[model samples]
Target: MGYVKLEIRCPKNVAIVTSADPDPVWTLDDLLSELNSLELQHGARISVSSPPKKSKMKEMANGSNKPFVMRITDDDVYESESEDESTDQRLITGTRFAFPDDYFSESDEFDDEMHEKSTPSRLMQKKSIEEGALFELESDHQLMVKEQLRSKLSSLELSQKIESENSSFAMRRLEKQAEARQELDRRLDKQYQRKIAEILDNHLSILQRNHEQRSQIEERRIRDDATLEEAKRKEKALIDEKLRQEKSKAEAEVRLNAIKQAEAQKAAQEAEIRAAKEAAEKQAARITETAVFDASKKDLTEPKGVENTRTSGNIKQGDFVTKQLGIRVIASKAALEAESNRLAIYDEVAGRINVIDQKVIDKHGRQMYKYIKQIGGTVENVRAKAHVLVQLIKDPMLPLSISLLVFANKVVSLCENPSGSFDKSAFACGWVIVLIASQVPDVMDLVLAEFHRSCIYTVPKHLQASDAASQTKDYWKMLGYREEDGKIESTNEFLNRVESCMKLYAALIQTEIVGVKNPYGLNYGWAWLAMFLNALPANRTTAVALEAFLKMAGFSLLRKYKSQFMKVLNVISRRFLPSLKQRGEAVHDIVMKLEQYLDDKIYLREPEGRQLQASSLSKFFE
Candidate 1:
């Protein structure tokens, strides 16, 4: 709800004034942009009455790169008016004729008696066309007015055609000149590179040949005999190493399997009598207890009543009970407060880790991710790169596990503003987290909590409608509103961020690096999908998040769950899409894409770039 009146000075200083909504003055930029398409010989110059916004105005300015705020003076306005009047008068020489039926003559005999001279009486009779009047001219120009107009129009069209062709010819000549210059530069550079490459190759080959010849001359027979034995020895050592790693991995899996079995049995025992939700809660608690290593560090116990420090003779039972209950109430409140503090600590840690200076990330983060991404593809290369990355960012004071998770935290933080190489290296970051979490399960919990804080749907939780004053702007911030300079982002931009976070989370679940299974794998993904669809209302934002998640994780889920995945898709089509339809154009396109993704069976084809190039892991996802 605002207004913007714009005064534009086109070429020849023709001043045009217009108004626009100022509530969102952003439209002013767009309105100015539209002026570029107008046929102004010199581009339109905008003149604003208000003080200039140096930042935005400079950005919106044309080639001169500053505000071209033309001052509209009386002289310029008067000249523009005179220019328009002259053009009008030149065109007024034409005979203004009306159809015979529409025209009504005031006095038809006046024209017969009238000589070839104009009189006020005759002029008064000829009113405008709207009054059903016609002009009876005394000048000879009326006889050939049609011919004159037709010739003028033809001449104008021919001149315009010639000008257009001349402009195009000039443009083509300039383009050819530029292309020729670029081609010459490219050929010169190519020749220089080729010569340098040839010189280096020849020098390296000569040195290598001479060294081989020397070695062969000194130990020809011995070297040839030992080569096979050396190969066998190295192969044996590699096999033993791989076996040891496999054995340790198997042991960890067995331990996890036993814990899962105990929970499964517990769930089965309570299935008939206990509420399914209660069982689920119990199961989740048990899994968290088993999986979260940091749980031991965060031992926050409620305070309990101590034995009577100084026992008096005899205490009333009711009084003692009342005192204990009050103590418990205070303790419970303290515990809840402590829990909120703990969550804040998690947020603080995540923020701190992700906010590592840009220079540090560029120096170490990308390299760390690169080594982790194609880890086993080339063992020697990965080893060397990972070592370099560790040296670059290593904290000798921290424990190995702590250092690894902290490193992973740094990598995840890059997703917050993926303006650099961080996005290209995201796959590696996902793998880094999964691999770290495989040994230190607290790592996964920390990452999930951070993502949940950023994007609520990763937790598959929706904000419930509430009238409480506490659930104001603070509530939206808690649900991860993106804020910059104390201003919240627009709806579309916020959703874009939500979608990015969802994609990262999806990548986390879809990962299967080396033999370390994704700790929170497709089962968790299945759970998220069910909970999201069941609880979250379908809207444009909902569709955006869901579409992003599916794009990253869908093919894998389809491969693993088959018909079950299809059924969930069916639910989305039947239940989710109709609600999304009412949300506007934003949702409409995504919903159509979602439908096409489902009906076209696009998930049957695995998404490209998802497949990592580990020796055996390459085809595992397929």
Candidate 2:
């Protein structure tokens, strides 16, 4: 038999069996059995076609029938072959097998030949060949199916992998965006914080500056208030002092007027008594003359008879009477003349005292007129006027001196008006008054007292202490001290002038004027010395001059006014020491030397007694 090919279809796989022999035949049952075996081996259900119909088999033998083909049906039987087998043949023939003509032939002879060749050995070989072909076909089909499945699965896996990658990339991009937003927010927050901090710092600095400015303003206000209060106090004090001085002056003037009035009354009474005495003497003389005349007439008429005796007696008596009467008349005349002369002398003396008083009044009026006229006068004019007044005070004529003193007193009174307007002219006038006092020793007490009163009420010039050193040097130079030599050029002359001034002040202090306290409230001598020292430079040379003056004046003052001298020492310690200490070592050393001298002269004599005094003085240095 030629090779035969049979195709069987299953649900999952298609199988084809081929035989090498022509006219190969097998029973339908046997074909079913082989198919079942393939199904079991391949793990699938297979089906075979039934044998062809007799007529159909004859037609196929005649080459007029279709090829045998089969497909598994739901009933486990193959589908019948169709007449249009060209497409099915191409599908089966891809396994490289050809269909036999007698494979589906129904001839009895073909059946017998198949039966004869279908012995066990031949069947076994055929079965083996069929199984091998089927296996080869099945394996080829499986490989093709596997290749298609692998390609489909690979495509699906590639698509899934791409989707997964896209999802992961999207998630990563979102995460990065979130991180970027967070970083941006953090940076913005930091910038906002920095701005806030800067604002706060600027506000704090502004507040600090404002606070400092306010504090400074407050301090300045406090200082201004303090200054105003001090000025008010000083003004009040000056007012009170001025009133007191005016009252004192008024009282002194009243007392002086009272004394003058009493002296005038006494002089008037004395003059009246002299007039009455002179009249009584004149009347007595007249009565005595009349009596003598009557006695002479009676004696002449009495008688011629006893004329001899009477005449002799009467003549003698008349002669005696006449002599007595004449003597009495002469005595009365001489007494009357003496009384007239005495009254004339009294009148002249009273006239001279009146004239002196009038002269003083006139001088005062003139001086007052000059002062009023020179109210705004130049310093030179004031100085000249003061010089004239000084000369007038030095005049040997008592009346001129008294008049100048009265004028001086008036000048002092004018200077003492603290409430009055102060001008340069007024200061110049005051200087003049001080100079007049310095020149006139006799009026030193009155002048110095007036000077003190004026100074007490008057405000000092506004001199800065900063210029004190230069001013002091200039003062020394003016006093004829040589700056290069650091000494007084005319020591003796300087000493003499200083001594004279000290003596004048000393005499003022010593004069015991009743009810008149020293206007400076200290020993006039010491007050003058302090005043001089205050005006001069607090330097060694000034101190030396002060020392000389003190040595000259201090002992006398101490002996006469011990308590006052003690007060002077206190003032010196309190006032001079502090200023001297500020000046330099030269001034300070001079002061120390003076203090040492005082200690040696005064305190050492009775250390126990003067302990408090020494302790008080020592406090200045401490």
Candidate 3:
């Protein structure tokens, strides 16, 4: 960070001569030393001054409190011993600063020849040598240069006749230019006068034509007006005669309409009476049928102590008990939460996240799960549909059984579709689940079930299933593996899918949407981390999920828990890493990632692309 660029100038010319080529990056004294060597090489007095005011950053860059002024005069070079210089020789080359030997190097053969020459001869031929630039000009040298310049300036004089001829040529050229301009202006003026006269003539003729047109139009309009008036008078007389006839016809038609209306009203009244009689008869029949049905139902229902003693031969055993139907007084999760005080705050943390099961649904009937899925929430509205999903899942209007079943299905669906961008689907699901868990702690049980069912380590548990207990494919499937007709997913891809799930889960654990201080946030994240490191054994699956979880939520956990959280990290370093290492190349990449995450302390910064529930909620609200 402590790097600087140098600007060098020559006082004689009062312009920047060269600049730092590589850019100086060292203490101020070292930069000043480089300047000294540069000055000695050029035999110029170099006075260095910094900016008028030093910046705070600049003050921090160096330890030196001394004034920012360092000068290396020509006298300083003569006084300093040669042994003080460093071994490396850097030179200012071209218009740039601080080039190496190759840049400023002269022809090798020429340098050798110069070395062979006597010092006096070298000084005599110094004007041609490149090294002449290295020597500052003394008083004698300045005088010699001025005299040479003056001698070169002295040359032959021009003849008086030649000078006079030149002056005459200049005067004649000026006269010619003036005569041409005057002729061009006269031509332009003549053209302008002709155009003006032409325009005026055209205007006068157009006005005369327009006046004649107006007169003709006026005469025609007057004749048309006289004709129109005569036609209007004739049409008016005819209209009066026709109106008289139409008035007589209308009086007769009105009498006929009135007679027809009276007859129609009589017919409508007769039809209404008939319809009323039919409706009354139908109503009487319906009442009679209902009376008969109620009498039959009373006879059947009120049979005194009558029971079906004879058993049906085709009926299966325990059919009567199994198929019995009655209203179920099923207790809901909200009722249980109230009883258990699952959401009650104790100490500093709230116990909002819980494990949901089929207890409530079992009371209602397991088929409610199927029913809930069928009539489940709609995903029609694509805008923040996840928030709506949370509401639907926890809707009390929906049967508890149906909500739990639908929620479980939704959670399990994410396991397969974790193949896509996590933020859109999988991570968004995590946000929904967190909110539901916070407000409705009963849902946490369902979330845990689905997560643990897919990846056990998400529950912070590792299982080593026996080969005899299940086939290889079945075991992998338990860990959320995908299978086609026969082929199973590759381990790396499986880890990728599982890692996305882990990211979502981990993110949800620590995600705090500002308004709703997540009860299951950093506090839960810390506990999850500590519990996972303490309980889980190291393996490729564990390694992937652990590393992914840390990457997702570690920043928030570290910030929240601080030193206590770091102790858990130390445990990971001391305990978890060795087990991963013993797995050889199977988990080599994961091990490396874990090691890097710890070494670099990547948890110091928030994971990218992970939207906390608070941010997501704000977006939804917007």
Candidate 4:
């Protein structure tokens, strides 16, 4: 077939750079201009054309190529070309070197003395004239033809000898192959027998072990039952003894009460006489002491002997004061101190106090009128004050609901007021308020209304100082992401957050493992880890790690946390399924490893052992 010419029009200015540059500066227009200049300076004689365009460009681009054409150059650019004299004979004529047309002319005479060929084909007839001119005698030409035939026969015999040798070698190879196959069959049969024997032994051992365990469990169960019965009997006996004690105590209490009644009357008379005598003595002492203390206080003399007395007097006063208060005062003081110690405990449970600036709200009223109108309520109508706010939340007004606006001024004021580390009342009140506010679908409409004219508070440097985004991206880097400047550069902060969330999810799953039992718990841990790994984006390193983890924990183990794993899988599979055939094998390989591990542990005593038998036969076919 005549090779079809390929062509492509070069842009007037385009120029392909010979070498790549880090800071190469070139524009589309510049490239077009360069190409046009190059073409004008050096025509077809200098510039080469690109390869041809075909209907299968898409397929070819993937990694396919057509036959090379001489007209096209090495560079991936195009130019048109014309057909040449040399055509592929197999494509055009189905044969090589056809007879020339001039042989059919009658101008050539057939001579008796001319060397003759016996062939009657069209090609022979055309070659007759040339042959007659070369060999004039028929006998001489015949002898030359006979010699050529002998030479060909000799070559044919040599070829037959090589063929015979090849046939014998092939037969020998076939026989050897048959023998090798027989040997393999014999070995396989022996292995199969061994496997069967091992399986039987494992079964027997497992049965024996199970029988022993069952008996031990039965004995323990019986012992537990007997102990439980004994405890119950003892409990009943204790109850009877308590009942008899209560009866005896009741009789004794009645006798003691009757005896106490007579003593009460005698005591009351004695207490009245004592109180009167004490009052007279206290009044006389108070008057005398008040006069003496007043007269002594007037004196400022620091007497040397009185210094020791003063010290002793101070010590005596401390002792007396402590004695008077004793345990009750200490207990009360301790209770108060404990309350202070626990102050921080409550703060954590509470939220910060968000005080609203009514003045700001009033000033921004007109600016926020649109929002208020949207909510079908006026800000002025909403209730204020802590307790009133809580109550209003319990029963919000129709159409208006509840809108709590924390103005920039209010936020600043609250930050300044360090009285409450966190305000419990404010947090509780806020939730209650929001509950009421939810009655209005357009709660934001009314809420933003209060802050319409308020300035957007610049986030405090202290609050915004956390490297949350960077840290999150770094965590993903560990999981595997394209790193930039020694850190993962995710397209958005949101993806980093997702990566961090996956890490948390993995941790939570492992935490949940602490509460699990064998089979069930192990499965749960494995499943959660699988889910976390699965949720990770399709990165080669991450995928490999996931496969390894899964293999250590089987897919069947996911049944341990079926509901949770399935929910995660449902979301992940949508993204993964398109490439599942490639990934599934990886997952399966990991699962097999885990399954084998579990089996080994569960049936250690079995003859076959816990390990899965390697599928050698399947591997051979593969």
Candidate closer to the true structure by lDDT (higher is better), 2 or 3: 3
lDDT of 4 by residue, 1-622 (tens): 1221212223346553222222223322233344445557556222222212233344556656432222325342222112111322111111112224533344424321111322122212333342343223322333333443444456678779888889989999999999999999999999999999999999999999999999999999998998998899799758755754684465346434533543464356436535634432222211110111100111112121110001111111001111111110111122222222222222211222224345544544333333222221112222223234333322222101212332212322221222331222222222322433443222322222222111110000000101222234333333223466775444333233322322222221222211322221243344334323222223222333343333333343354655654544443344433332233343454344334544454212221111222343455489
Model 1, 1-622: lDDT tens digits are 1222222223444343222111112122233243333315345443322222344335646544432233458996687556544543222231122234312344535433332232223222322331121111211123233334454566778889999999999999999999999999999999999999999999999999999998887697778668978998799768766864685475456546644655564355335324422322222211110111100111111112100111121221111111211111111111222223334435444444454555654545555555554433333433344455455433333323334445555555555665443333444456656655665554565567567556766765444222233334444555566667876555656676777778778877887766777778888787667655644456556677898888878899988988888788877777677666644454577889888888887878776547545434545656
TM-score order of candidates, best first? 1, 3, 2, 4
- State TM-scores per candidate: 0.40, 0.21, 0.36, 0.18
Please give, for residues 1-622, the per-residue lDDT of candidate 3 as tens digits.
1222233333556443343323222333333455566667778635433212234325535754332333458776544324223312333322323434542345655444533441322222323222222222222233333333333333212345566778898889888888888888898988999999999989989998999899899989988997899899789758755764584365346434544554575456446645644432221111110111100011111112211111111211111111112111111112222212211211001111133344643433333333322321222222244455555654444444346545664565555555444544444455556655656555665555556556655655433332222334554555566787887776667777678768767866766654555555676566556545533446677788889888888888778777877877777787678756765565689999999999998989766545433333445688
Candidate 3 structure lDDT: 0.50
Candidate 3 ranges beyond 4 A from true positions:
1-387, 394-398, 423-427, 465-474, 517-519, 610-622
Superposed Cα deviation of residue 599, candidate 2 (Å): 28
| Alpha-carbon local distance difference test for all models | 0.52, 0.44, 0.50, 0.33
List the candidate 1 regions with Cα displacement exceeding 4 Å.
1-394, 399-405, 418-425, 439-441, 467-471, 614-622
- All candidates: CA RMSD (Å): 46.3, 31.9, 44.8, 46.7
Report the alpha-carbon TM-score of model 3 versus the true structure: 0.36
